[model samples]
Structures are given as structure tokens and as C-alpha cells.
Target: MSSYYEDSVTLVAAKEILASLVESWALFRLLCLSQNLWAQEGCFPIPIISATPGSVIPWNESVKILCWGTPESYLYQLEILRNSTFEVVEKKLGFQEKAEFLISHMNTNTAGRYQCQYRKEYKLSEHSKTLELVVTDIMNQDYTMENLIRMGMAGLVLVVLLAIVIGNWHSHKVPNKEDWPDFPELSRSKHKCQTGPLDKALRDTRALCGKAYCKPGNKKTLPS
Candidate 1:
């Protein structure tokens, strides 16, 4: 009777051990399956990114950077390249697999290469393609060389105008009598002015009388 009882106890113990081993194997298989599923879910596709109002923005203006990812994504991150390394600048919760980051009062500090990423649970998706942001304020800034050139041109124009005005003034001025060229009629008038009254009367009588009347050997009537 003792021997039969010992056999029964030993067989019962053996069955219990086999049951425990089967349960452990089943649990290990289930754990492996769950890990595979988690890994598959974590492997997400790369996200897409774009900027609104164009990637080129004016200083003090605003821009909207949009990122899109898989529907399962719950969080989105925006990163910028600074000093050759990427740093997260903003984050947003995903909605419909999309996220928007509004950057206001944009300046030189805000302009650079940017990227976006999305996270689903504990795994993050691959980063999106780089987008370049450009900020311009050329109209407002003063360039030394450009300003100097403009000033030099303006001064040159003023000098030219002054020279023209002076030339016109000099041209319009009345010339002195001494500056005028001498003519036969002017010389004769000057000679007349220098002559005496008796010479002037003799010249008038010769002018009124004919040359034949004035001749020593001829006689003719002179006009009254």
C-alpha cells in the first residue's frame, strides 16, 4: 500500500511540472508576439513638412510651418539647425495627422533649415525633409557702399547743374563795348565825334554839292 501511494504522489508531481512548463512556454510566445506587434506599430513612415506664406518671409512678419504624419501620430516636433546641430524649437499635438507651428515677428534668428517629426506612443518617426527659411529686410537696411555711391552721384549731378547755370548766366550777360570787334561804320562814327565843327560843316557841304561843282575848274549849281 505504501509503494502504491508513493507512485501516485510522484505521478501527480510530474503532471504538475509538465503543466507549469506548458504555461511558461505559452506565456513566452505571447510576450514575443506582443513585442513584434509593438515594433511593427512603432515603425512609422517619414513625415512631410511645408511652410505657408512662402518660405521666404519679410522681417517682423509671420510664417506658418505645417507638418503631416501618419494618423496614429499623437505628437509633433519642429526642429531647426543651429551651429550644425538640430534642436527642437517647437512642439504641438497632432490633429488628423497634422500640426501647425506659427512663428510671429520673424527675424534673422528665425531663419534657417528646419525639419519636423512625429511620435506615436514611445517611438518617433523619421525626420522630414529640410525646409529653408529666408528673411529679408534689404529695403530698410543701409549699405555703406551703396549709400556712398548714391551720395556721390547726387553730388556730381548738383555740380553739373551748377556749372550749367553759371554757363547760362555768363552767356546771357551783356558784353562790354571794348569787347566788341571794330567795324568800318563804328570807326567812322568815332572819327566824326573827334573832328571839329568846321571840319564837320565842310564835310556836309561836300556831301550836298556834286563833285563837278566842287572841282577847281568846274562850275555847277548846288542844292539849297
Candidate 2:
């Protein structure tokens, strides 16, 4: 009967009983009190840990992690897998002291995921939930003005070639109508600016006298 009572009073078993209840500040304080009260009641300290996964770290930069736990024995480490299958693994130690790691460059690959591993002096602690980071080519311009210009010129050439193939020709016409002559209107305007050499040849001789066309020695009229 004593053995059954001892097993029932253990701190591990006590915490297990507390786990079923919703966690809150009051509940946590009660469980802690129970653990302290049961120290003479012969039980190991229940392990507590805090870590963040599902976070993102950009490529080509340092990855930083933070982890804290009770009893001061919980040591944290961060690691990454190079390949998709995790066939290659990279690990580090002492994240509680220094939580930063640098990403190594690869020839082809761009993105990867990181995870935190915590241990109390074991080779592998339960790995954290995975966090993913994205990598991109800083060199490539996605949409450039030069590329758009080239595409537009190519499309214009293609359209012109198709029009030629479809038997279309454009008739040429000048815009300013005054630049082209109107012969009848110019001849009949009866202005000083309208006199021309070809028109002078067709006029009757009985018109009003002009000194410009008069013979030099025959200017005087004979009783007209």
C-alpha cells in the first residue's frame, strides 16, 4: 500500500496529471508549487524548453535563433540540410551563447530550411519544427526596359511583314494643300503677284499698256 502511494505522489506523475488541464499562469504556479513541495516527495525536475520554428531567414545572410529553458542544462544548437532528402547535414553548437550561423554558397541551389536542435548533453535533441528561407538571383532583372523595347520592335516588324504578305499598299499623300499648285485659280486672281511668262505670251495686244513689255524705240503712240 505504501509503494502504491509513493508511485502516485511522484513529480513526473503529478505533472502528467496537470498536463490534462488548460495551461495558464495560475495553473503553472500551482504545478511549480506542487513540484517544490514534492522535492522531498522524490521526483526529478520536469524539463521545460522554448524555441521558435516556422521562421524565415533570407539567403546569403546569417541565421539567428533564440532558445531558453529551465534548470540551465538545456543547450541549444542550429543546423541545416543542404539537399532535399537531408542526406547532407550541417550542425553547430551553443546557440544560447551564440545564435548565429552563416550560409555557405552553392553553385546552383537557391533556397533552404533551418532547424534548431536542443539537447541536455546528448548528440541529438528533439529537432525543432523546420523553418524555411528563400534565396534569389540578385543578378537577373525580371522585366527590363531594353527587353520590352526589343520585343515591341520584333512585333512591329512581324506586323509589317504580315501586311506585305496580305497585299496591302499605302497611297502617299502630302498634308499641306497649299504646297501643291492650282493653275486656273492662280491665273484668274488678277493680282500683281499673279503675272507669269507663259500667261503673258497668250494675252491680246489691245490690253492696257505696260512699260515693261514696250519696245524701247517705239514707246510713242501714233494718234491712237
Candidate 3:
């Protein structure tokens, strides 16, 4: 009876120890899972970097470099490299989730590669994909060429219209000789009958006979 009591006590103690070990293992696993969850939540995600009005900017114009995809209350850092070189031309810091770095009066020196990263407290995210900035005066040149083409076309149209108007005026001013009637010609004998020396002499002889009237029978018919 004494040996059975001792064996029972030993069994109970062993069971209790085993239970404690199992509980400890489970607690350890739970602690590890919680730690992992915290680590994941603390880590920062990669940000997106881009330029407003496209990557190709115009000279002496303003451009906006945007950094997005970050959580609120995070800080952002924008960095630039000229001509893809290791040298950094500019760096800017921001506090908003969506940050903007404005380059006013951009010039040749402003053209280069740009990248951005976000940070939450001491944790920092990986740098975003590089964006290229190309500054040029080609836009102005294209505008000038377009204006010249428009002016030239307008001048050509004006010349064509003026030619049409002038042609119409000239055509209307000239009379069509073919539409006029032909005048009849008079013969020489017909002209002489109308105004000749014989006609004039007959008119004078009739006038003299009327005035003579055998005046007082004084030999009025003398000189032939």
C-alpha cells in the first residue's frame, strides 16, 4: 500500500510538469506571432515618384515632382541626380503622405533622374523607381512654326481672293464690241444732194426774184 501511494504522487507531479511545459511553449509561440505582427505594421511601404505635365519639361517652366502612396503623418525625402550621375543636385523633405517638390524656372541643370522615399519614425522605405526629367525649348519652336504656317496660309488665301475680285472687275468693265449694231454708210452723191453749191444757188435766185417784183418798171431785169 505504501509503494502504490508513492507511485501515484510521482505520476501527479510528472503530469503537472508536462502541463506547465506545454503551456510555456504555447505562450512562446503566441509571443513570437505578436512580435511578427508588430514588425510588419512598423515597416514602411515603397512610395511612388512622378512628375506633373509629364517627365519631359519645358525650359524656364515650373515642374512638380510628386511622391505618393505613403501613409499619413509620414515624412518623405526627394532626391535628384543629374544625367544619371551619382552626384545629387537637390534634396527636399516633406511631412505629408502625398508630397510635392516644385522646381520653378527649370533650366538645363534641372534635367536629371529623380527618386523618393518615405519614413515613419525611424523606419524608412525603399527608394522609388527613378523618373527622368528632360528640359527643352522645342515647345516654343513648334509653336513658332505653327504660327508661321498659319500666317502664310492666310496670306495665300488673301492673294487668291484679291485675284478673283480683280479679274471679275476687269471682265465687267470692258464692253463687248460684237454686241453693237453696224452703222449704214452714205454715198457721195447722196451727201452732195443734201448740201451742194447748186442747192445754195437755187435758194438765192428765189429770194432775189421775190425782192425785185419789177420795181417801178425801171428796167429791173437788166444785168444777167
Worst 10 residues of 1 by lDDT: 215-224
- Please list the C-alpha lDDT of all candidates, in the order they appear: 0.90, 0.52, 0.79
List model 1 lDDT by residue over 150-171, tens digit each. 9999999999999999999999
Candidate 3: regions farther than 4 A off:
1-42, 82-95, 139-148, 151-165, 168-173, 178-224
Best by lDDT: 1
Top-TM-score candidate index: 3
Which model, 1 or 3, shows the larger lDDT?
1
lDDT (10s digit) by residue, model 3, range 144-183: 7788999999999999999999999988885679966787
RMSD of each: 10.9, 17.9, 12.4
RMSD of 2: 17.9
Clashing pairs in 3: none
Enumerate clash totals for all models, in the order shown: 0, 0, 0
Q: Give the TM-score of each candidate.
A: 0.46, 0.30, 0.52
